[model samples]
Target chain A: MPSPAGTPDADPVRASAGAPAADRAGGPAGEPLIEVRDLTRVYRRPRTSLTRPGEAVHALKGVSLTVHRGERFGIVGESGSGKSTLLRLLCALDRPTSGSVTFAGREVAGLPERSLRFLRRSLQIVFQDPMSSLDPRMRVRDLVAEPLVALGEPVGDRVAELLDAVGLPASAAERYPHQFSGGQRQRIAIARALAPRPEVLVADEPVSALDVSVRGQILNLLADLADELGLTLVFVSHDLAVVRHLCETVAVVHDGLIVETGPVDDVWEAPGHPYTRALLAAVPTLEGML
Target chain B: MLTVDGLGVRAGDLELVREVSFGIGPGERVGLIGESGSGKSLTALALMGLLPDGVTASGTARLGGRDLVGVPERRLKDLRGRTVSMVFQEPMTALNPLMRVGAQVAEVMTLHGVAAGRARERAAELLGRVRLPDPERIARSYPHQLSGGQRQRVMLAIALANEPDLLICDEPTTALDVTVQKQMLELIAEVAPALLFITHDLAVVASLCERVLVMYGGRVVESGPLREVFKHPRHRYTEGLLAASRLPPRGTRLATIPGSVPAAGRFPGGCVFRDRCAHATETCETAPELTAPELTAPDLTGPEPRGDGHAFACWHPRR
Candidate 1:
């Protein structure tokens, strides 16, 4: 998959797909594009009487991270490990009870409602459930073009071009989602997320729902998109193999805590924490670890 | 021993499951592996006689030397949780939203004739046994109050309430994160019940189960020991699943199966995997009879071929 609205320098980035990814865009140790500090979200348990609930559920336990610009970073964890909470908080769909977020040196945590919309454009999100995320009634092209319409941007005629960037034919614009397969729908979702030309793309379990037969292709597509677009990718998945195959740097979470953070190769080779080691050991392999 | 002989499930004109059969020795842990709609879960449901209305099943299922296929509804109901219990895929949906977690668990024992107040104590003990923190505090909470992992522990507590001889786990750890999933597997291994652990995740099956039953298109494609089957899967479908999985033996790019499991009911009379099988030939036009191809391997068998406990139904065995 190629990046949309390509500039003259796109060919070089695309050519580097066969080369080492870490050196593709030079070193990533510059100023961080996304900085999260002590972010936490809590939910109260349901109760019948006026009696207050006990200690609140700690969906997020002080998660803080610095994501460098153009770095393909990954957050790996199992269910209820605060990965989803961190994603939601970053997307601004849910408010953090405590903590701050600085996006491009701008404090996103305190961004007003009107400014949040503008911020949303620079930070795009692709959710786990593509079936539910895309409207069944709407055709592919219309769904891809929704962001453009929402922002009242003048990309009216560029919709077809966006669809092709995600490896879909221009003709797919007219067909409804029911006509396409699971992997096809995810391709459309990726196209929609790319329609705005966002700098950072956060895909939450993007390939988790697809069949195993088609998962590798989707992973390759996402990786290709990240490389070509020079996009800072934050891939959230419980799958260690997929994360290992994609991301350069990784963060491991357990029970709402950031257990460990390191290079993907280092952690995979010799996990520092016992939880990470167990997590590594837990990955079902025909042989062993990646 | 549980023996399923020529079990088939038909709904309307569609055959959801076709002539599925397997045997689980006492204290056996058999992992059933397959992709979605391949009839793995449906097979489990059919075993429990929990198929939807209009679905008809044929053949006989004998559980511990007793017939389960034609057993009356009353007898099956009595046997379901008492003699044979199951842990479903989703813990949240399996639990009742309106009831307290403890009461829901206790309800299982109570239904099987445990006293009213006694069940709660039993429930708390099971919860503690599963390593839940602060069992008393958690017992008072509702299903919605607990986390996904905690709720899963509750489901296990409920299923094991009676200490049934046979415990059927249908993708029990699919909803759990990796660490919790390992812990859950360790718990199941410790219990060492006659387990039928159904899952698509091959790694969990490989590490946890001693034997495996690989399913495809609502049929048992391959059955054998875990490590042995992994190294040499006789059927092409089994090879495809193993290849598709990224875990295990790195350097192997997941061999895409090219197509999904065919829809049930109207499958071709030819070999079930013929459409996707690379070795498909005219002989596959007729469904191959279940054979002992795996039994003939020099390294596969010990002293005698028939005694090693593995069987595969395929015309063309992998080299």
Candidate 2:
């Protein structure tokens, strides 16, 4: 078997340093970047009795959606709503039990690791907790350069460039993740995610862990990055108001199903479904109350 | 029914909380809002006399006219769960795993000298009051058996079992889902009296609190009637927080506070927020006093009652 670090030549479409911005911007609608068709994922719980098999958990029940190229799409749901499962399926980290997930017209649901070079290069994810997502032992430089290194790409001044893009000083490269505050650590995470120059940036509850004062900073950073890079963003959050702030279109998932899908403003203004209405009502907005 | 004056919490030489002063009137709800490391939780812990090992509290925290600072653990314990009770953020860990939910509620009353039989009966009643579905069945269930919302309701049941004069809740609904949080907030509002609700969510505070206290770097930077302070914040930190909380137009950048919060005990001397504030001047190197903002009208009377004045500590506050 080959070493853990794959050969750079294996993937021909390596993102060049200082790629031009707006290369993928201004794409017309109806150009689907990610298309799902009746996607479903099921898991079996651990067995408790000797006579019976483990009970099956239908995590995603016939979910379907489309993400347009260069579009900002948001998936909003509470815990146990299968939003995480859907994200994993989209990233090809997990295979669907049934149905299909396609990326730019190519099937990715059951693609093996070796066959996922394009998917891996085109998509990157930023997780919720910066503390757990970043490696504590590694310096900020190595952490940011990790994806590049793993792809067997050359280690140039890309680390510094990424740190700068994420609004961190060059001095941060030498520090460990613990040396930074929560917001700064999240910036480090964003820098690492962008190091690969992925066209699709999948952020899972990015600002949920940061303080309210710093939340806006991170959100602004993400919005600015997405716009400047012209990257298609798939943001998953539990708060609809937060999703509305960053995403143009939204899909509200509940009980492993898409309960509502529309422009964020339409859904916010007049929710059609009962669950959607209930969710909007329950959001505890500062609108008139403040 | 609770008055905290110059409350400070120290871990050895490091001052984690400094000169935090506030009050909660009889049956009035007040919120202590701050991000992590801002010493909001530390203030609650100090008031409860539950500071961690090697940490000591200074200054006076009077509950029902009895000073809680420097009090014996036994006396504090006596005061706890009767005169002043606390409900923590995570209900799952705060409760005992082995005990039934009802028994845990009953134990608080039994510990405070209630008869076992009466306590058991009252626990069921308290569970019902918290609006937990199937109160008897819920009482028999263990903490692990309940959902996050139900578990929080159970914690509320236990906290309210003794009908304490003051209830201190530290991010009580933060762990639940939005819908569940709404119900929990309603339940808390219906039950808790003289509440000191602590949370980082501005929306949650606005929904529940009549008064607000904004803490930053271990100090109460701003406090006032919720609407007035939120509408016209005097402190830069408070202004930034309210701006950040609102969802601006899509595609536009949010009005963000420039820097992250400094770690505890590492805040700059003098003004704790000067390093992050945009209006900081040379004079900001000296700490600004937490005084009521000057009013334009000369005929204005003296300071409002214990819990009702708009006060902030900022060298150059928003006009």
Candidate 3:
């Protein structure tokens, strides 16, 4: 792992920081990589169980969507709307009570553990906080290299190359997780996510923890990575501003169901759902000028 | 009315806020907008005597005619939850997780010697005032049980329990999602307490505040009515902050401030914003005072920068 440098934490802006319209135009659209039909996940409260009638949280209720190959699709919702649950289910980290998930048309929802392992690298997720996501004791290189190692791929010098790809200096891979700023740490997290060159990335609130100045930087980095790697990106966030700027299509989830799903432009200009409209009105818009 | 003059705070040898000053008339909403480490939250803490031990605050924060600086801790406590109250940024931390919502709120009135039954009654009223649904049911629920918005209303109920003359809300809506944040800010704006609101959400700041104070690196760079500040930010830092904000009419591309907020330990000897400023020059080597208005910064966008109430502080401010 590399030493986290430059900013307080996670200097997202320096990471090719955010996209210009030209940058968004880099990648062309492709076919459906992820297809879901009535996807649902029910989680029992932390320590509670199913036998005793626990406060069963219905995280996903009939979430259905088609994520085209190499497309940037954003899913937005309030905290409890099951966005996180859907991510976990798509990554095959949790089982859905009743739903169909066909990744690359392979019917992955009920795939056995052995089959799921092979599919894991194809669908990766970048979480909110790098501090919690990356192990503290591990060096930056090892953190990124872990995925490659797990996949039985020879890391060799690619760890240092990955660090530079995410805009961190090659020297960063040697430092512990705490040594980096928040933005730097998240970049490292991104490098680790890209280690296996996944076909799709479920980035859940990746930039929400970053400051506005750095947030733009992180948003741009994702756009560049998606274009360069030709990966389908499922960007999940509660911030409509982020969704509007980063994604081509959006799925607005509310109360465990998707209330509004459409292309970003139409939804932003003429939102049909009251919840989507409210979400739009709620975000503080920037004034005209640079 | 609330007025702060020459307010300076220090943690050891590092001066966090220097020569800060601002005022809010009764029922007027003012926003102190800045990013992390800007001392905006710390200023609110100083006004409420909530500064941690070892931190020294010097300056006069007068509320309604009483001098808050140098006021003894005991009197400050008495004044707190009664004379002046605050709604913190994180409702979860501000509230006790184990305690019932009613008890946390009722404590304010009870401390002022209001009877237990009456305090409980008043707690529900406060909750209802904040537009909380089923005040009675909400009163019984614990902090952990309430949603983020509900938890914030509970915090507001407690802050308004004694009906203080001033309410300082620190980034009150940061933790909330876009939808929830809008509702919470609207609820707070409608209540219209004499506010000294602090936030990084420039759009929310523009929407809610009447007067604006733009801080950078623990110093007041600009202060004025919202219309004036937003339209024509005279300070280079203010310009960067406004440009950098994800608010309406913003540049299509993400506008950046070149560098990050300078850390406190390495306080710059000159203008606080110089290291990261696009307009820095040899003159910045000598610290610039929060200067009086001279050059009228034409609104970079056009027509809205000035309605005669705006002001700025800078030696080399951008257009």
Per model, how many backbone clashes are there?
A: 10, 0, 32
Expressed as tens digits, the lDDT of each residue in B32-84 for candidate 1 is 88888788887788778788888877888778767777677888888888777
Ranking by TM-score: 2, 3, 1
Error in Å for residue A55 of model 1: 6.3
Q: Which one wins on lDDT?
A: 2
Output the lDDT of residue B309, model 2: 69
Best by DockQ: 2
Measured by TM-score, the strongest candidate is 2
- Interface C-alpha RMSD after superposing true interface residues, each candidate, one decimal: 9.2, 9.0, 8.8
lDDT of 2 at A115: 97
Residue A287, candidate 3: Cα error in Å is 4.5
- In candidate 1, position B246 carries an lDDT of 59
Residues A1-104, candidate 2, lDDT per residue (tens digit)? 11111111111121211122122334337478898878889899999999999999988877787888888989998888789999999999999998788999
In model 2, which residue pairs have backbone atoms overlapping below 3 Å?
A: none
Label model 1 with its docking quality class. acceptable
Better by TM-score, candidate 3 or 2:
2
Give candidate 2 misplaced runs (Cα > 4 Å): A1-30, B292-305
Q: Judged by DockQ relative to the true structure, which candidate is superior, 1 or 2?
A: 2
DockQ for each model = 0.26, 0.39, 0.25
Each model's TM-score? 0.84, 0.92, 0.88
Residue-wise lDDT of candidate 1 within A184-242, one digit each (tens)?
A: 78889999998888999999999888767667667767877887888999999988777
